[model samples]
Target: MSVEIRRVQSKKEKKSFIKFAWKVYRKDSELKKYWVPPVVADYMKTLDKEKYPLYDHADIALFTAWKNGRIAGTIAAVENRRHNEIHKDKTGFWGFFECINDQDVANALFDSASQWLKAKGLDAMRGPVSPSMNDQCGMLVKGFDSSPVFLMLYNPPYYNNLVTNAGHKIGQELLAWYIDQDLIDIKRLSRIAQHVMKREQLSIRTINMKDFDNEAAKIRDIYNRSWEKNWGFVPMTDKEFDFMAKSMKQVAKEHFIYFVEDKEGRPIGFSLTLPDMNIPLKHVNGNPFTPWGLLKFWWYGRNISAFRTIVMGVLPEYRNKGIDSILNAQISEYGGKHGLYSSEMSWVLKSNEAMSKLAKVIGGIPYKEYVIYEKEL
Candidate 1:
């Protein structure tokens, strides 16, 4: 059967594009474990020409693959100004990708994205980045044992084959580690960390929520400096950072967000963790706007069992000085005190062996894995 690819046009078509995953994964028991039903209204808002800030500086196209007049797959093509400005490259991104095991459908989606990017004069296309890599930007290649943690991508195993068969090569790989509370070597690390701290005059402390702006500024500086050498790294704009900070204000635990400062009070490193909202989000099937879903979320949020270590970074000069162990020890200490049992230190790059090894040293299990694929266009 031939698959026809067309840009999402009407409201109904947009709905079909966003909700196609539900139909594709409906009968698959494995897909149901951590499936978060995409909130159609909220997703559409992101693509709106008037509302989304990215729309102001980017060209976007949403395409749905149709077979026999029904949506079979979907993908979104974006040429983002922010990405271009940071990388100084005319590269485009393909995101929100989903499809059946059929090569025709995958080809249809890829062809549409390529044509759209070419029209924009982009030199190359790289993604599975739904809008941006700062968000979900990968396909699962290994470690598919459990449902994805909060904000991580989950897909069928065949998705990787489909992507590679479509000619996409490995662009980058992100790692996810599961930390079991029962097996942590916190006492050993704590003793070592104490010595390291005393020798280096380094101390770990929680960020002052009252002085969040000052703290955020320090984080911004450290993030830009620490991750500047990473592949596809972009210095987040002020608006982006502020937007994230505002969102974090609601769910961020004061103790879970920590900073390591030098003897002279310079911010040397930081780690940010959030209660794994996926537990409750899984119950709601991904939507939390309804009164019942909101109630369940509120109820479950108060008693979250797992936390996600979303961001952790140390300055270049501070690396390999046991600063990471100090940060991890602080997180484990706080988790023990707060009744949080387990944590997920995730989306680490596959090439980031140092961090991955450190995660294991702190008793984090390699549980989940996500992959990013690319194709030259």
Candidate 2:
């Protein structure tokens, strides 16, 4: 029973790759509880080059490893042009990776993905970034005790061995801080926030859903400016940003997204906390649209008591003026007001000291850790 790696070429093969994770998780019931199944159709859109706009700026190859006629693993190799253009680094990525506990299976999959990127002239390979860093990136290296909030990934504890066995070293660590709403010192943070707000004449507001396009334009401005210098960052194209904004609207609550502005009405910072959809999504089997699935989705959704702060950033010049504290305090206050008990401000880069300090200041626990691995291609 030798394992073999094959390229995903035909449509049927693509389908096989999309569905292979279930097989990997099916073998581990413990993993299954933490692993939320993605909607079959949603994954299809990600793999379909003509459909996913990301392919517009990225070159990619998909591969699967098989053993005894069963799918043992899957991976995607990607070369994002925008990343190289922005960072001036010839680095590629491997993501959407899933495999059995066997290091051999993991090696085969990595070998295939690496070879493909090497051929593309990429100097190094790094990731668990399914395609690009803007999306779901990083492999869960800690916090295996609980299920990941929606859009955050979950993997078995042993998966760490697969990367090291494949000769990859940790390239970076990403943190997901668990904030117990009841535990944060909001009163203290609030005092700081008020001081900063009054001194800077800063005011906070939520997205204007009535004029969403206009609102999105403001967010786009802050996002591009705030995160331009962050590691592995590439600003999303106008088309990409608009597409994301439109899609997010489907699940958005106006109160959950915030904007902080100066007295002159310049948007200086933003934070987006998506309600933890995983609670409901888990029951819906990943697709929220099937008749019964939608019913289950809404039913479970009403009981959602948490959120994940997907992204939060401030313009570089405004970094030390308590903007981060304001964001944390506001999020804590909002969650408590709404009767939410828990939230996660996640995927924070380990190198980001400001965020680490803010997490500490707000009583956030680094409960989940995700990592990016790298190797010379």
Candidate 3:
């Protein structure tokens, strides 16, 4: 069967592009078990060129593949000038990718993305980045037994084969580690944390929600500086940082966020965790506005017992000083008192030995793996 790839133009076409993911996942009951529907309205905003911060420095083209008049796949080809400027590489990105288990359809989608990117003078293409690294940006290659935690992604196992057959290579591997709160030795962790703090002359404090903007500013600074050395790191501008911070604030728990400070009270590192809202989000089925959606959200929201450590960073100078251990101990300590009984420290690059070690130190079991693929355009 021939697959026809067309650039999405009209608002109706864009809606179809977003809704196509439901069709893809729901086609199989087993695949639906682990898939959480992202809020449709949120994606609508992202599709709007004027509303999304990424558009300020990026160009994106959405495309859909049709087979026998039905949508078979969707993809977005992106040229992020900001990423290129920082990384000094002529790389384009493909994201918001979803397709049926058809290599021809997947290949057509990839061809559309590659042609669009190549037309713009980009030399390479890399992603699955539903937009950017700051967001969900990987293809799940392992651990398909359960649902992904909050902000993570789940996909059909055949996605790996589809990408590889499309001529993409594994550019990087991302790992997710599961930590059992019940198994944590709080006393031992606290002892090590205390020693690290005393030896480093550092103090830990919770984010002050009352001073939300100011706190976010401090965190944005630490975030850019701390993660700058990581592979594929793209510095978030103040506008982009503020945009993300606004969304996160709605779901953020003050106590679940922490900052490490020096004796002088200057912040050096931070950790941000949120309740595994995917648990309830799954119940809402992607829309939390409808009457049924609201009821489901409210009921399931109360039972959320897991947390996902979304981002944790320590300044380069302070990394080996054990600030990460202090932050981890605090999470296990406070989370136990509250209702969070388990956590996932995720997307740690396979090459990041320090973080991988920290996850294991906290008794984290490596569970899920995701891959970012690349192709020479």
lDDT of each: 0.82, 0.87, 0.91
* lDDT of model 2, residue 213: 94
Give per-candidate clash totals.
Answer: 1, 0, 0
lDDT by residue (234-327, candidate 1, tens digit) is: 7777766765677677778888888999999888999989888777777765578889989987877778889899988899999889888888
Instruction: List, residue by residue over 1-377, the lDDT tens digit for candidate 2.
Output: 88898889988888889888787776787988778887777778777888778889998899999988888999999989889988988999999898988988998999999899989889899989987887889989888989989788988889899998899999999999998988888789889989999999999888889998998888888899999988888898887788778878888889888899999988899988888888888877667888999899889888789889999879989988889777777888888788999989888999998888888888889998999999997
List all candidate RMSDs to the true structure: 2.0, 1.3, 0.9
lDDT of 2: 0.87
- Candidate that beats the other on TM-score, 2 or 3, i.e. the better one: 3
The TM-scores, one per candidate, come to 0.93, 0.97, 0.98
- Give the C-alpha miss distance for residue 132 in model 3, angstroms: 0.7
Error of 1 at 312 (Å): 0.8
lDDT of 3: 0.91
Collision pairs in model 3: none
Worst 10 residues of 1 by lDDT: 33-42
TM-score of 3: 0.98
lDDT of 3 by residue, 1-377 (tens): 69998999998888889999899888799989889998888888887888888889999999999999888999999999999999999999999999999999999999999999999999999999878888788899999989999889999999999999999999999999999998888899999999999999999999999999999999999999999988998989898899889999988998899999999999999999999888889988789989999899889997678999989989889978889989989999998888677999988998888889888888999899999999998
lDDT of 3 at 20: 90
Q: Which residue runs does candidate 1 get wrong by more than 4 Å? A: 9-12, 39-42, 55-57
